[model samples]
Target: MNFAKPLPNYLVKRYHGWKATTYSENQVWYRRLATEGQRPRAMVISCCDSRVHVTSIFGADQGEFFIHRNIANLVPPYAPDGDHHGTSAAIEYAVTALKVAHLIVLGHSQCGGVQGCIDMCKGQAPQLEAKESFVGRWMDILKPKFDLVADVEDSTDQARQLERQAVVASLENLMTFPFVSSAVEAGSLSLHGLWTDIGEGGLQCYDPKEGKFSEV
Candidate 1:
C-alpha cells in the first residue's frame, strides 16, 4: 500500500509548462468545466497505445470526449456477475449516467494487445496462457475473433485484420448490455467502430451493411 510515489521530474516540468500556457490561455473554459461538470456527447473506447491520440484525431477540446482506454480496446459480453469489470463499468456510466449519444470503439495499427491475442491463440505465448496472467485473461475476450483472420497467409496482414476485428468484436459486445441496446433501439444512441493507421495517419470506419471497414 506504500507504493505510491511523487511525480517524475519530467512530468512535473511538463505539467508546469502546460499549466502556464494552455491552462492560462483557457482558464475561463477550464473553470466553467470544473463548475458545470462534463457533458461529453460521445464516449470513445480505445486501445491504451500511446500513439493513438483520441483527442487529436477528433480535434476535440476539453470535456468533449469521455474516453476509456484498455488493452486491444476489447469489451466483454455483458456479465453482471459483480466482478471487477473496469471496461463494462465505464460503458455503463457513459450510457446510463452520461447519456452519451455515440459510443465508438477505436482500434489502431500494430496493437500489441491484438498481437498478443494472436500469439496466445496460436500457442506461441505460453506466459499469457497462464491463469494468473491478467493480460492473458483479458485478451481472452478477443480470442474468438482470431479464427476469423487465421487463414490469412501473411503475418502483418493477419495482425492488421485482427486489429479491425477487435474493434468490431467490441461493438458487438456493447450491444449485449441492456442499457446500450435499449438506447440504440430507441434511436437515442449509436455505435461505431474505427481503426487508425498510426504510421500513415489514415482512418477507416466499419460499415455494418457492407460488412467491412472503409476509408473515412
Candidate 2:
C-alpha cells in the first residue's frame, strides 16, 4: 500500500519539456479535448510492448484512437461470468459507448508474449504454465492457435506465423461479443487484423477470404 512514489527526475524533466512545448502550442486544442471528450473513430487492441507505438505508427494525434494494450493482444471469447474482463470492458465501451467504426487488433513481430506462449506450449517454460501465473492464464486464449504453426520447423517462421495468428485469433474472438457481432452485421462496425515487423517497419493486413496476411 505504501509502494507509491513520486515521478522520477528524468520523467519529470521530459514532462516539463513536453508541457512547455507541445502542450503550450496546443493549449486551445487540449482545452477543447478536455471539454468535449474523446471521439475516436477506431479502437485499437494491441500488445503491451513498449516498442509498439500505435499512435506514432499511425501518425495519430491525441484522442484520435481508443487504444487498449494487453499481453499478446489476445481477446478472450465473450465470458460474462461476472469475472472482471479488462479487454472486453474496453471493447464494450468503444463499441456501444464510443461507437467506434473500426476495431483493429494490431500484432507485431518479435513479440515477447508470443514467444512466451510458444515456449510454454513447447514445455520450455514450465513457470508460465503454472496455475498461479497471470500471464499463463491470459495466454491460454492463444494456445488453441499454436497447433496451426506447430508443424513449421523454422523457429523464425513459426514465431512469425503465430504472431499473425494472434491477431487473427483476437479478431475472431471479437465477434463473439453480441454487441460487436450485431454492429458488424448492421454495417456499423468493422473488424481488422494487422501485423507489423518491428525491425523492418513493414506492415501486413489479413485477408479473410484468402485466409492469409499480405503486405500492406
- Candidate 1 per-residue lDDT, tens place, 1-216, comes to 789999999999999999999999999999999999999999999999999999999999999999999999999999999899999999999999999999999999999999999999889999999999999999999999988998999999999999999999999999999999999999999999999999999999999999999999
Q: Write the per-residue lDDT of candidate 2 for residues 143-176, one digit (tens) a residue.
A: 9999999999999999999999999999999999
The deviation in Å at residue 150 for candidate 2 is 0.5
Clashing pairs in 2: none
User: RMSD to the native, candidate 1?
Assistant: 0.9
The list of candidate 2 runs beyond 4 A from truth reads none
User: Top model by lDDT, which number?
Assistant: 1
List where candidate 1 sits over 4 angstroms from the true fold.
none
- Taking all chains together, each candidate's TM-score versus the true structure is 0.98, 0.99
Question: What residue pairs are clashing in model 1?
Answer: none
lDDT of 2: 0.96
